[model samples]
Target: MRKIKKICFYVLLGVIGIPSYAQDYSISLLPFSTDNYDEFSPAYYRGDIVFCSNQKSTIFIDYTDEKENLPPLNMYRVEEVERNVWGKAELFSKQFKSNANEGPATFNSTGSEIYFTRNNNNKKKIGNFIDKNNRLGIYYSKFNRRSNEWSEPTPFKYNNPAYNFAHPSLSEDENYLYFVSDMEGGYGGTDLYVCKLENGNWGAPQNLGPNINTTGNEYFPFIHSTGRLYFSSDEHGSIGRLDIFYSEKVNVEWHKPIHMDAPINSRYNDFGLIIDAFKKSGMFCSDRQRTSDDIYAFTPLYPMFENSQRQEENDYCYVLYEDGAENPDPSLFEYEWTFGDGNKARGLEVEHCFNGPGDYTLELNVIDKLTGEVSYTQAIYPLKIEDIAQVYINAPDTVEVGQEVVFDGRKTNITDFDIYRYYWDFGDGRKTRGIEATHFYTIRGNYIVQLGVVSREDKEGNSEKRGVYKNIVVVGSLKERGRRTSD
Candidate 1:
């Protein structure tokens, strides 16, 4: 790590050249994936996952829908065998069965309660939905500890046979409920809506505004513990078909939605994303590999960051106030800073900027206006300038044609990172590896220099490589001097 002066109050995190926030995601289709079956909408529950799938159930033989000759979507539970591994998936419950379709779901923090999607006419005993459901509806159910089964499902008070209202997601505190609906007065196909749990019942629904809804469609709402909302939309845009997007509500308004990057998204329909509170790993639904949607587990190579400000590049600047000198007579002699790099300043306190990494003998002389130049030097300090702890390369940002520029990594400072080798890419079809290398440009132009630092593997056989870059400008002659880079 690069150490900042106590005055500056800046600390360098143990990262390479990367300062901007990003997540490198790796994904894998779960072992439960089947070619003929469809599975999606994974929800964390009871230290495991409950998802909607149309796969045949082992407990209920011949569970296929007789009308469609295909299995209808049903809730299934999968237990995690270990990290990033899951065992077989089975029917979520026998008591929570419905005659119509059952889709996306969300569970309370304790996993004892659930709010899920089902056909509004699931019972089909009332109103105009006697034979078929006019649209979807949200229902709540709880685990019955006495019978060791799920209790009877209760319809949401706002459930109307006129429009669709499904994909329920609950807030961490269960104080707010987010869901999708096309009930009317919406932007387009489907819009996200939320209701506050005032007293003991849910309040009126509030639209998420035009920023979240579009003329297209948005569904699969998942409210993370951080209050950021994740959902799928096609009107906003698409990488494949329906892509996943997330937005954070500031104050009362929601920020513009941000599209997720691929493998989380793909050239196929991707939606129903559920990630952990740490944002390190999670599972999502995508149809990139097969014709049917399948749940895939994803993990990030590095931790994700939010609300992180951009880091300023260090310029190797420092101030020398006391040169570790004994008390000297201020009336007799004044302090003069003689930096061995051909720079000199006279003061008790002065600032200096080093060009690059090297060893320099810093001299402190005492002189007075009343007296002539002091014959004796007050302090002789050995100042060795080293680069900040990174895959640091010491090179001039500007050079001349045919000028031998020294590329040095000897001063690369990193205590925890055990570097095995240093690799260089001059961006001119040339590459080399060492602590130091010398190169020259044939023609005057701009070239990007890359320094690759490789680390030794750990006991787990895991290693990483970090590359840092520098922009070098080459000039034809000395008369056309290049601009000096920041010190």
Candidate 2:
């Protein structure tokens, strides 16, 4: 008689076997402008952060209105030499003008197309508006890398006559274009809309739903690579006048927006957030220091997944036995197992097994020394043996009469036991076949549904039946009684 060694593996729950470190993030402010009231909308594209600032110009005269004290803001580009060190800021003279206020910039993936908003006084002369000075509209300019010059800016064609359009952001795939607009037919002030960029033409815009926009204003919309949206909103639990808020799409619906807290946001205004997909470093403009608004970079230290930090322990063990033999190989071969937890082990004919029950990929690589060649790897999955095969039946527990209802049955355990046939007794003299069977109950009453499965092979060559039962209550109504049957 062979001695059967039953190695019981205890599957542990919530055990951290391997330690993981949090990803470190750092930021460096670019030396662009020391003058007060400057710098906003810092965007990273092709390894450079392009921003807007109101720095003192050496050649041009002061364009600020001495009475109102509004300075001219020109766009600038700052290149990063190393990881933390930023190169000197250079004014984009060829692209920006010295006339009116220019700011709130966005760039494409390749840094070829640049879109920005400019307060066009000339547009006021073309059309009269309530707030003439605040009549800002978006403009588009293409950058030619070969010549290192930007083309003349042109007004975007889709600007509505009712409201101003600003703060444009392109989707990572560049298939959809999102921008903030105070146009009509919106839920509230300055609603965000996305339009499909089809064949180089912008299509009609659609509102981003009520979750993102409210009766109050929502602006500076930035979409991250991970599909999380970041924007500024004063209406949604903000710390101050305008605070940055972020929300992600779950199950095709946007969840309730949450405020970005403390260091990244302050009591003062924080807007214009930008993040790189690769490094996950975020940049935004904040007036937290009580000085002028400066561009600040922050590394988001939050875990990527909500369940990423929580480790699930496996303590249940699976016992592996040969198909017909009780005691097989004691020292005839080697053992190699992959635990699927980013770990692996190798030994020569060992009896020790794993300590947990989970989806593990195990492989046994054997060697033949006489032939000087390796044998085929044998793979086996040790499953928990249960007496009753737990089957989940997915169907309505209650249904109206004459309604076609679907019954689904899923069986677990008994891997080699093939279900040869299925018999569903609908308790109304009607029977059906197949794992997922459909039946219509005629006349309203309480009925018991039974699913019978037959095993393909048995010792006597006869099929063995496995039964599953479910109780369904049927309601009788005028509409349900009048319903016609397909048969």
Clash numbers, per candidate:
2, 10
Model 2 TM-score (2 dp): 0.55
Residues 17-115, model 1: lDDT tens digits:
212323447888898877777788899998899998767665454444443455556799899999767799988887666555676789999998999
| Model 2 root mean square deviation, Cα atoms | 23.7
Best by lDDT: 1
* TM per candidate: 0.63, 0.55
Tens digits of per-residue lDDT for model 2, 173-243:
87767788877888776687888888888888888888888877787888876566888876676656567
- Candidate 2 segments exceeding 4 Å error: 1-30, 33-35, 122-134, 145-147, 301-487
RMSD of each: 16.8, 23.7
Name every residue pair that clashes in candidate 1. 315-487, 334-367
- lDDT score at residue 360, model 2, on the 0-100 scale: 58
